[model samples]
Target: MRTIIENATLILPEGILKNGFAVCTDSIISQIGEGPFGKYNDSDMVIDAKGNYVSPGFIDMHTHGAGGHDFMDNTVEAYLGAARTHARYGTTSLVPTTLTSTTEELLNTFTIYEQAKEQNTDGADFLGLHLEGPYFAYNQRGAQDPEYLRNPEPEEYNLILAHGEKHIIRWSMAPELDGALELGRLLRSKGILASLGHTDALYEEVTEAYKNGFTHVTHLYSCMSTITRRNAYRYAGAVEATYMIDDMSVEIIADGIHLPKSLLQYVCKFKSIDNIALCTDSMRAAGMPDGEYILGSRDKGQVVVVEDGVAKLPDRSAFAGSVATADRLVRTMVEVAGISLSDAIKMITRNPARILGVDKTKGSLESGKDADIVIFDSDIAVQTTIVKGKVIYTQNNNLKS
Candidate 1:
């Protein structure tokens, strides 16, 4: 099957191409060029972009759930349900993230993920799993359940690796905790991404953690320490170290609620578009109407409320999660943070794909790359989503066969 998208503004790695066209032969992009499109087979499925922007589909690296289903729901349906929901919002690739949970529950999720992935033909492709902690610090545990938070234990983590090594892509934890650096080393040895998150680590510890292979930061500026006083002596914290370090990549939940506009702009200014990726950090409430929901497994998760476009604890003490979608994140960065449309799209598409080590064929619009594309308008509203050359979701019925 051939899919052709023409007369659109293409977001390419170098820059935007006006009146560009892309030809997808099966799942791979066969050709891409600017100006008028050349001849094609009469049987080709051609889509006129109507002056909208055609770009690489978004890649979400740290999303927990969407469409009223969390990854920790421990069901195949829940996993695929969230993936499908994200796909509708321009996420062609996603890494299903887990919250702090029991070992048994984590193993169950691993089993379910394997099952769901086999049946995930109609949703966004699952890159892998991101284990977000049973290894975080207690005070920095934002919305993560405190019951499961603790220092890394070699025995328990090693057992987890034994069972879940193949499907685990990344793991986020507090690097300051006991045995955490060793855990980072173990993850690095296995080729899994080691990330710092939910921590109170100082600059020195963060520097050491980076050297030990913790090269990424999860949900930057959230659940991380800043400057603090230790015995009347002010010390730089993890947040400061993130800026001080030149090569460390970070993901931010650019939902406009979790982070204010000024802070988002500040991050973009310092981190640059290449080093910063955008994440939703969304919960089950994503794409759902404002209401009550669970943040993890139904039986053991905490109850949270979605209101004012963000999830929050019932007491309103802190943000439980975000209800933003991939499209919303791009829109927030462009409109709220004063970022250009091209750069904002990169944060959601190219940057995350690179951070997750899938940039060789997935991040941008190029010949011989996967046909994971999204068409959106000036407002960044996702009008069509094509995954692996298949028109998975379209707003105006633009698919032929």
Candidate 2:
């Protein structure tokens, strides 16, 4: 099938192109040019963008679940449902993430992920599985089950990796923990992304982590250390180390709530667009009404309340997770952090695709690339989402048959 989207402002890699058009042949982008497409036969599927911003579909590298279904729900239906929910908000590709859990639960998720992918239709394409951890610092393990948190165990991780090496794309953990450097090397050798998260590591530990293949920081500022005093001596923490490292990539939960405007601005001001990615870090309550919900698997997860646009523990002492969608993330960056639309879009698209090493085919709107596209208005409200040239979600039946 030939699909042409015309009369749009295309978000190209270099800059925005007004009155642009893109053509999709099968599942790949065949052409992108300025002005009208000139002629179209009845066989062609022409979509009028009405001057909306047509950009690469958002790629979320870290998201647990949405639409009342967590990936840890341990069912194919749950996986598909969450992906579908994010697609409606402009996510065309996403990595299904798992919270800290048992060895058995992690193994089961690996099996379930394989099953989910085989049946994933009408949803955002699954990039791969992101294991958020069974290894972390107890003091910094926010929202993660403390019962399962521990230092990296060579025997336990090696066993998990042996079974899941094929499906796992990335693993986040506290890099300062014992045996973490070895695990980082193992994951790197397997070409899996190793990232730092929920860590209380000092600058020196993070520097060592970088050499050991921990190239990314997960959810910067959230559950991560900043600066500390050790016997009246100030020491840099993971948060500060990220800025000094220069090449370290990081993802942030930019829900406006998880990070207030000032903190969001601070991150944007310090981090280059190429070195940053936006993630939802959302839970099952995303796209659902405010109320109580679970953070992981239905039976074993912790209970949290959803209100005030974010999820929190019942006592409201800490955030359990976010409820923001892909659109809200872009909106938060642009509207709250005062970032340009193009840069904010890049944080969710090209940056993540590059971080996950899938940039060659999925990140930008170029010919020969996957035709994963999203159309949104000035407000960053998603109007249509097309994954691999398939129009899965369109607002108000905007596209004609």
Candidate 3:
């Protein structure tokens, strides 16, 4: 069946088009224009958008879990539950992120990824899995399990390649670790994205890693060094690498609690919207009440609690993660970070899609692209989420009443 969403404020990366209509056939957009699109055809389902903002469905490049389910659980229910929760907030596609864990645990999680890949559960499309650890520097481990942190081993990489499905899109590693550059080169050979994060590497080391095919910086500024007059060499760390290299995409957790509002604005000013990707980096406690939650594995210990929208560990040293969704991240960028709505939307959608090398199919609302769309009211609240022309989430007025 075909669908025509009329009278919408179409939000695009370039700009917004008012009173536009998007026509989708099967699972791809067929047309977009400013018009009534004539009378709806016999086979068409016409939706009155009522002046709401319609944009490409968000693509979350980094996210752990939600709705009381962590990806580290390595269970089908956990993955699907997180997907459903994020989909309700306007995310159409997401990478299920994993934390530092043992080799056996990672292999077990990959099996779960295979299962989730095979099944479509009427929620956000599971783009792939993101391995965020086991190959990081222990000093900057953040919320990752310190016990499981280690240098990348070729045999372990080979094992992951053999058992892991092609859906493993990106892997995060500390470039300074032994054999990591070689592992990064191998990952690039297989078309998997290699990202640098959770490390205490200097500027020269980061530049060397970039030359070896590390094209992304995960969660910039967090678990990374800052530039100072006394520590200028350390400034050449991930932040400098991200700013200097145009091809390198940096992920930023826009939740106000993770980064100071002033610093977040400064980053956006240095890096164009095209070079910055917004990520939730959320954990199991996202979309739930404040309480203790687990991150990597059961044996890794509990993550801190959520209070006043900030997730902190018991010692208050660093943030465990965030409870914000992709939609909320965009909104926060606009409301707090002083960014335009269109630019913020691009950070979450087109920018991340381009970084993951899936922009042609999933990013924008261009003709011939996947019909993954989101409709939200004026207040930036998600009203409906559509994935591949199928309505996955719709607001229920009865519940609200």
Candidate 4:
């Protein structure tokens, strides 16, 4: 049976569609256009959007967890809880990120991730795992457990490849570190996205890393390199290099607290929405009341505190993570950065989907793509979320699943 969402202001790739309707046959968007798409048969389920702005459901490529559940829990329970929490905010798909931990721990995370994907829970779909650590620059390691940080080791990586690379979609590391570039090439060859992050890599180093297949940057402008003086000489850092490299996609925490509004606008000025993804980078603290929580694995996690709308290290020297969801990210882009709704939606949808290599199936509201959609009012508040062509969440009904 076909489901028709009529009377919507569609936010399409090219522009917006006022008084439009979209047709979803099962899980794919069969058609979308402006005007009253003709009268549908009773077999077709017609849902009125009430003239809301409809967009593709957000795809978060970088996130830890939410609802007091970390993905590192090594259990299906954590995955379901976190996924459902983010889905409530319109994330139709996401990659569960891992913290710096033992090789054994990372493998377990991949195993749990595979289980979640296979189970196909009602929350946002899981693409794969984002390996955020165990390969990084120790000096720039913010909120990451320093004990687990180190340069890339081939022996360990080879073991990971042999065991869990199939479940790994992206990997973040410090490009300047020894053996890191080789690791990036290996990850690329295996079809995993190699992202630069938690580093102090210079422009030249970053260029080398990109050439070696580090095509993405994690949490741009945070824990990344920028202008710095070295023995009276000023040099552009990885941050500037990312801006200069047109094709290197980058993600921002976009919760307004992780980065100031001016900095967010500056990033927008330099990078197109095509290369910028808005990620929550949220942790277990997200969707939970403000308080102290763990940032990684249960047995040996980093203690962090949530205050003033963001997570921070216990001592307050660095930020632990974000307590934001996808809706807050979209809202910040529109209200704080003064970005247009269509362009802002692109940041959370098309851009991340493209970077994560799931665009063919997930991003955009187009014919033949996955019917993952979100409908919102003028303030960018999500009124309803449709995942895989199913209305899984709604604001008016106070429903979440």
Candidate 3 ranges with C-alpha deviation above 4 Å: 228-235, 298-303, 396-401
Task: Write model 2 residue lDDT over 67-147, tens digit each, in one string.
Answer: 999999999999999999999999999999999888998899888999999888799999999999888999998899899
**Candidate 1, TM-score vs. the true structure?**
0.98
Clashes of each: 0, 0, 0, 0
Task: Name the lDDT of candidate 4.
Answer: 0.88
Better of 1 and 2 by lDDT: 2
> Between the candidate structures 2 and 3, which one is better when assessed by lDDT?
2
Residues 1-401, model 3: lDDT tens digits: 88788888999756999999898898999998996778666777777777899999999999998888888878888888899999999999999998887788878888888887677658789888899988988878888878788888888888987877486899998999999999989888888899999978877788898898899999998887545355443245667767878778899998987877998898888887788899999988888998777765555657586777867887777788898887889888998998898998898889889899899899898999999999998778998888998778877431111
Name the lDDT of candidate 2.
0.94
- In candidate 1 the C-alpha lDDT for residue 80 amounts to 90
Candidate 1 colliding pairs? none
Relative to the true structure, candidate 2 has a C-alpha RMSD (angstroms) of 1.0
With a 3 Å backbone cut-off (N, CA, C), the pairs that clash in candidate 4 are none
Worst 10 residues of 4 by lDDT: 392-401
Q: For candidate 2, give the lDDT of residue 186.
A: 94
TM-score of each: 0.98, 0.98, 0.95, 0.96
Off by over 4 Å in 1: none
Residue 144 error for model 3, in Å?
0.7
Off by over 4 Å in 2: none
Candidate 2 lDDT at 355 equals 94
C-alpha lDDT score of every prediction, in listed order? 0.92, 0.94, 0.85, 0.88
